[model samples]
Each structure stands twice: as structure tokens, then as C-alpha cells.
Target: MRLILPILFLTILSIKAFSREVASDSLANIARNAMFTDAYIQIEGKLHSKKLKVEVNLGDTPEQTKAGKEYSEKLTGKSHMLLS
Candidate 1:
């Protein structure tokens, strides 16, 4: 019984560690993709207004300009939901 208890505890610890590693790897992949993804930017509003709305593409396309206006709008909606 004593031996079983220690083995069980170690097994649980190892499982938790493995899960953490997997989670971290996925997070890293997400970060890497975001960093390399092509992006398009738009600037609106007049300089005199002292404010400008800047937008960028967040899609996985190789060229953001080729993604079309609709693509950006779609991606932006998802991002807005996440921000909210």
C-alpha cells in the first residue's frame, strides 16, 4: 500500500507536468503564427481631428492585401469579440 501511494502521486505529478508542457507549446505556436501573419493597415480620420482609426489584418493569408476587404472585416469581428 505504501509503495502504491508514492507511485500514484508521482504519476499524477508527471501527468500534470506533461499537460502543462503541451499547453505551453500550443501557446507558443499561436504567438509565432500571430507574429508572422501578413497584415494590412488602414488609417482614417483627418489629421486635424487629432484622432485616427487604424486597422490591420489578422488572417493567415500570405498577403493581407490579397485577402480582400471582407476578409479583414470578418477577422476584425472575431478580434472585437475577444477584446470585449
Candidate 2:
């Protein structure tokens, strides 16, 4: 009877552990999908009778210019770029 209790306890513990691992894996997958989501930046302007338009898919949301320059540099490896 003592052996049976220990075995059952261990079994239940292992099941809980497995369930937690599965939940962690699912959450990780959701985070990975969100990380890979697509974002964009579009610019349209006129320069002295010339019209210019630019569009780019950045794969992430744009931060404000003050906080975003670093992120843009990290994404493109370029300095002094505007993402918004």
C-alpha cells in the first residue's frame, strides 16, 4: 500500500510536469509568431514638383522616432534612419 501511494504520487507529479511543459511550449510558439509578425512604414512626399513615395515591410511595429532610431538601426544595421 505504501509503494502504491508513492507510485501514484510520482505519476501525478510527472503528469503535472508534462502539462506545464506543454503549456510553456505553446506560449513560446505564440511569442515566436508574434515576433515574426509583419509591420510596415510608408512615406509620401513632394519635393519641388516631384512626388516621392516609399514603403517598407519592417517585420515589427515602429516605435516613435526618438525611441525607434536604435531599433531601426538594429533592424537595418544603418545609422540615422527613420522608421516612422
Candidate 3:
């Protein structure tokens, strides 16, 4: 019974892990700019906390640059480089 329970639990975990979908190209691109990348974050440890880092070097795209300019001009009244 003990062995059965452990096997069942492992099977469940494996199934859940396998159920996750692979990221699409756009989603993978977005992940490069997500909070999980290139950000210094404080992580809590059992005894102490430390600043953790995840570096993400993003190659800029024209679409992202245009979006940023639009956002800044429309929302913040700031001039930004126009996306060509």
C-alpha cells in the first residue's frame, strides 16, 4: 500500500508536468521581457533573504519600440523615438 501510494503520487505529478503546453513563438518572445527575466528580486530563505537575479538580454524589435512610443505619447505625454 505504501509503495502504491508513492507510485500514484509520482504518476500524478508526472502527468501534471507533461500537461503544460509548449510556449508559442510570441509567448516565448514575451517571456524574454517578462518580470522573471533580468530582474533583481528578493527571495525569502529559511534563515535569511537574498537578492536573486535573472538576466535576460532582449534583442529589440520594431513592434516593441513602436508600442513603447505609442504608450508613452498616449499615456504619459512624453516624446519617444518613433517606430519606423
Candidate 4:
């Protein structure tokens, strides 16, 4: 029914917002933990590179695609060393 759709939408939105907040808090904690410093940095770097990869693959925005290609080129030789 119409009421059912609205109720489901609201419930899903609330759960998504709550999870986003929790994930943000967890990321902050991970960044602050000295023991996790290296791991955190590595994970962050990989995430950035992966996002750039998606942009390069899509080639939707000219500016983003160009920047991503340049950035990825710079990482070509270094990624192997760092990721290892």
C-alpha cells in the first residue's frame, strides 16, 4: 500500500544514516590509533587510487579522467612496492 512504501523508505533512510555515522566514527578512531597508523594510511591511499581508477574507467568527466590518468601514471612503478 501507499503507507507501506513511505514506512519502508523512512526506515531504510534512518538505517543508512545511522550506519554512515558509525562508519565515520570508526574511521576516525582507526586514524588516531598509533598501532594502526601505517595500515590506515595504506588503506586510505588504496581507496583514493581505486576511486580514481573508477573515474578513469568511466571517462565521464574530462577533467577528472585526465587527472586520474596522470595520477595513475605516477603510481605505476610505486604501487607495486607500496602495495607489497
Of 2 and 4, the candidate ranking higher by TM-score: 4
Per-residue lDDT of 13-63 in model 2, one digit per residue for the tens?
Answer: 989888833578888888888844354555455433234344555444345
What TM-score would each prediction reach against the true structure? 0.26, 0.24, 0.24, 0.26
Report lDDT per candidate: 0.59, 0.55, 0.48, 0.52
Estimate candidate 4's alpha-carbon lDDT, on a 0 to 1 scale: 0.52
Model 1 misplacement above 4 A: 1-36, 60-84
Steric clash pairs (candidate 1): none
Error of 2 at 36 (Å): 22
lDDT of 4 by residue, 1-84 (tens): 989999999999989888833578778888888442111111234643543221123244676556667655655534334444
Model 1: per-residue Cα lDDT over 1-84, one tens digit each: 989999999999989888833578888889888855455566555544444454665565555455655554554423222222
At residue 21, what lDDT does model 4 achieve? 38
Give the distance in Å from residue 52's predicted Cα in candidate 2 to where it truly belongs: 45
In candidate 4, position 65 carries an lDDT of: 59
lDDT value, residue 18 of candidate 1: 81
